[model samples]
Target: ELHLHTDHLNLTCSTFHDVHMIRWRLAIEEFGPTFHSVPGSSNVVADALSRLPITDEELEENPTVTMAAVEAAMSGEFTVDMRVIAAEQKNDKDIGESEEREIAGVLVLVHPKSKKILVPTRLRLRLVQNYHDLLLHPGAATMVITIGQVFYSRGIEPDERKLTDNYLACLKAKHPATRYGKLPPKSVEVCPWFEIADDLIGPYGRKRFRALTIIDTATRLIEILPATDATSMEAAYLMDRYWFARYPRPTRCIHDGGSEFKREFAELQDNYGVERVATMTRNHQANSVIERVHRVIVEKIRTKSINTQDEWANFLNDTMFAMRASNHSMLKVHRLSWHSDVTCWWALPTKQIGKRSINAR
Candidate 1:
């Protein structure tokens, strides 16, 4: 019905079965509305809003006051309480006699006899699918609220426990777990405790570039190497040349399960007398140290690449320098501020700093 008033209904999927295509075409012809396909990324508003968690304050507030204020700010229109509107939707038979009626400043058509929400059958499926795609796959509770808003009633409720169970089943089927047969380092002082990896950056300019990031788990000292490719030879050469020259021979080296760290890379590790260890496949928590750093680096890249992403490689050094200078909660010290003479890496507290003549910079 919403699409009927509008010229077009935007869709995310382009292809469908022959039977579905025919049915959809016939529905559009009958309804006098066209369908336009759009990318998933374009549905940002629905995606973000669906994932937004409701606060305790929001739940306790009167819906009439809160919703009216929000609607007034957005559209200069007053709204009735959602509870009142819901009650009317459930029991108001007089409203169904009219072709359309306004609730909270929005016009909706009511069913003639049943007084249920009157939505076109074609749109009903699309509406449900969108809600599921954005909220239900994650088993979020927002689906219930969204259904009420679209259908103009709080009567449409789904079994949340069942939805969550189904979502978990699907998630497990898609990503099976891997076995971890070894234990982690006892403490940060342990040697050969590092995560070496690389990720791809955009096509914002001529071509996409690979960024090689290495981090020492103990010190949190980071090294960023921007390159053109992430091949096994490049990774091996980096370890042999840059890494080996600075640090002592390690007992173990942790590697992400990229093609760059495959058979030949394992041989390179053997040459250095380093036992190669791989992180659990597709598990971010297994390599959380590097994963956290990757997020920060990518965010910085996006922020600093306002003019052109061609020069993102140039900003890597400054970004990495800042990250290394920052304090780490785990280590209890600034990552790069440690000296060899210092036995303890614990940073001076703010209260202690005031009593000493310290030059932190």
Candidate 2:
């Protein structure tokens, strides 16, 4: 045993003298005044104590959990709330989203195993900041980084290409000067069956009819199901079936808080076992793909006097194919490269030309 105080209650050097005296007298009395080996260390005792978990490795691996680490976490000495950043779950198809997050790009992702948040490397951050300033949003400062060609950050993915291009088009759009602090997104790629983004596409005439579109973030594939009524409960039931029939039970689905998305989707979390992520309201940057699609509709929709939804639907059939073949600047692949929708980050990929030998000569 290690003792800091003596039994006699002495406060000074007197205790040290008394302790040495007692030890000597006891040794002589117990050992019959004979010389003997004096053990300087207890190897057995040290080994037993060393077997307990006390290092960071032991704590992070989550091996045999100890009450002490738990107490430390509870007391705020160790932040063990790691469940929030386990990795952005993926699906069968993977993508190379950026390294740093854009505005409103916040979502779940695999965080650094050692820290709560991680940002793009210094070089990458500088590169993105420069690209955005010179080529697009001059005030835009960062881009997301990825792990093994994939990842996620905390905010949203704006039409970085469009924003930049539009600014440069006229060099005078009187862009907004306001800015907001935001969470940094993590680098990640998509796999399959873990993440999904869905949204409703209507209010055209306000008869309460809507189209609930859910997409596999990994494959970039889309599933559009029409909801007869625009209520949340009805949309939820229909979407649940559409999701379960196609996916292998997803972990999370992103949506808006529109009355359709908010009607108790979480309780379904227990039944279907997937969490719901609602992007910021009035913030289309988070759901850039769909919003961009809407813009395409707005720009290209002919004001022609074709007075039939049936005729419009027939013509719209070709829009999907056209958008798919076009390459996207952000994802660096055609919208159809992985999924069926017409969407991309930058201007659609430019078509290349080839020359042929003239036969007339």
Measured by TM-score, the strongest candidate is 1
Question: TM-scores of the models, in the given order?
Answer: 0.41, 0.37
Worst 10 residues of 1 by lDDT: 66-75
- True-vs-predicted CA distance for residue 126, candidate 1, Å: 54
Q: Candidate 2's residue-wise lDDT over 90-170, tens digit each?
A: 221232332333223545333444322332332223333333332212222222221112333333234333443444321
Q: Please, what is the whole-model Cα lDDT of each candidate in the order they appear?
A: 0.48, 0.42
Model 2 scores a TM of 0.37
Candidate 1 local lDDT, 105-214, one digit each (tens):
76556655544455433343344444443221322344543354335333334343344346432343222222221223533333223334432223233345566676
Candidate 1 overall lDDT versus native: 0.48
